[model samples]
Target: MSGIYIHIPFCKQACHYCDFHFSTSMKKKEEMVLAIAKEIQMRKSEFKNEIVETIYFGGGTPSVLTSAEINFLIAEVYKYYSVSDNPEITLEANPDDLSSERIIELSKSKINRLSIGIQSFFEDDLQLMNRAHNSAEARKCLEVATQYFDNISLDLIYGIPDSSQNGEQAQQMSNEKWKQNIETALSFGIPHISSYALTVEPKTALNKLIQTGKIAAPKDDVAQEHFAILIEMLEANDFIHYELSNFGKENYFSKNNSAYWLGKKYIGIGPSAHSYDGVSRSWNVSNNALYLKSIQEGKIPNEIEILSVMDRYNEYVMTGLRTIWGVSLDKIESEFGSGYLEYLNNQSRKFLDDDLLFIENGILKPTKKGKFLTDGIASDLFILN
Candidate 1:
């Protein structure tokens, strides 16, 4: 089944390291939501069968929308698409927006999953990232949220301002202390977790701070070490490291994202979101005013690209290598012809010999060592022709 993604391009405040297309000014909230609903209605035929299996509310912060706004948006989705009986509808929320009343409202709505952005449990780290929530609110929201939903996921930021990871005056948190954060969520029976290192993206406020010597740059070694610890700790807690940055226990994998990884078709609504079918990819313009005005004029301000054979091969190599499923030689042979399959087999030989990759049941899977360097290896194996 296909999926749908809606982008809410407004945030209460900007996180220093974020580079997402969002505006802190939410004067256009009502207009934006209406436009998104209209966009979905206009593009209803994009996916032949409206039997959608997943719907994702991602954004500047989906939580920024009021409960009434969320209800209206979801109603529009139901009107436009034929939702699955058991659809996985997820909303990306921040800690500050989640209260007992809001959580109860969300539980009663069609939304079945909550992906909370509780980036750090430390007040200082929250301050460093310009996160709007404090340590107490971060801890409290989870308590309020869990009382309503069982299939919950949370985000955690690692390699932040900490003496443990080597910040000048930051308190040293023990590895056990790091696990404490994970354990707290797991205790709530959280089914999924997405954690990432604090990356200083170019032109971001965090990058500017590092340049001005106001904040330190993240250490790669320290980030890697933290990642290792995170993996070990979560695995011990029975969470499956399904994707590089995502972990899930039992059957709680993100269906919307899993569809993307498996190369399934999906449509995206609103500004700055991407849409992909097997053969082509497209994205809406990131500007809110322009996006709404164009859509109102019966135009989709977007660009599309039809994938070439080489492009498809490269994409397969890139996405396939990131997952536990790896690249299947049989899949390549069937889809791209035997010549391309032979080329891949020959190219992967070096990695196989180095113990970075292994051929298991004709599928090339990455070793623990290979996972860290997947991007480089995927590039090396790309069919440029």
Candidate 2:
């Protein structure tokens, strides 16, 4: 089954660590919503034959849109595409936007899932990341949201660097405090979590802060230690480490995200959104104004690349290794040729010997030790062309 990812490219305010395409201006919100709907209509033919099983409202912050605006978009999807009877419609939101009334309103809408961004449960961490929501709002939103929605996912950012102390970098969160954050999230009774490390992307305020010594850079050793604690704590509480950074309880894996890892086709809507067909991948222009202008002109503002066999293999290896599904060695041999298969085996030999990777029932997967480092390991196994 395929999916459609709609990028809402507006935010209430800019987060320092975010490099995602977004405008802090709400001036173009109305025009953008119209453009997005029109684009959905324009791209229906692309997914004409595939059943749209997932409709994901992602990025800069979907909850910024009113429920009616959101409903209008979902209506457009149903109008043009052959959607499944029960499509997984998810809206990525921030805690500040999810007030009790807002939560109730969202629960009544077509959005069956909420991925709330709760970077941290402490005020200092919130201030450091410049998150739109505070520690109290984060907890309150979850408490109320859980009452309205059963299928909810909360985001947590780990490995955040603390303030410089005595001319040395300190950890923002002690292990005990991190555990408290986890416990607080669990207390909300949310079924899913999409946790990630705080990476300082280039050109982001985070990078500049680090360079200017306004903030300490995140330590890899500290991050790894946190990651280990995350896995052990979550798994002990019956949460499956389905993806490298995702933990879900039974029957709660993110269908939209899972579809992506399984190499399913999806059409990405809005600026800076990426789409994938089996043989090619495409992404829209990152500029919102350009996207709106092009969409208004009945043209999709996007670029496409026809995937080489090597490109496809590399992508599959990268994505597959991150999830529990793993990469199928037999499928690799069958689809990419025996030479590619042999190359993978040879490249993976050292990792397998190191117990960082292993083969079971023809599927190659990362070990617990290697799961945290899956991205690095997957790169080592890639066939460079």
* Number of the top-ranking candidate, with TM-score as the measure: 2
TM per prediction = 0.95, 0.98
Scored by Cα lDDT, where does model 1 land? 0.85
Q: Put down candidate 2 lDDT per residue, 204-274, tens digits, no spaces.
A: 99899889877888888878888999999899889999999999999999999999999999999999999
Worst 10 residues of 2 by lDDT: 163-172
Residue runs of model 2 more than 4 Å from their true location after superposition: 164-168
The TM-score of candidate 1 is: 0.95
- Top of the candidates by lDDT: 2
Q: Write the per-residue lDDT of candidate 1 for residues 289-320, one digit (tens) a residue.
A: 99999989989889999998888888888888
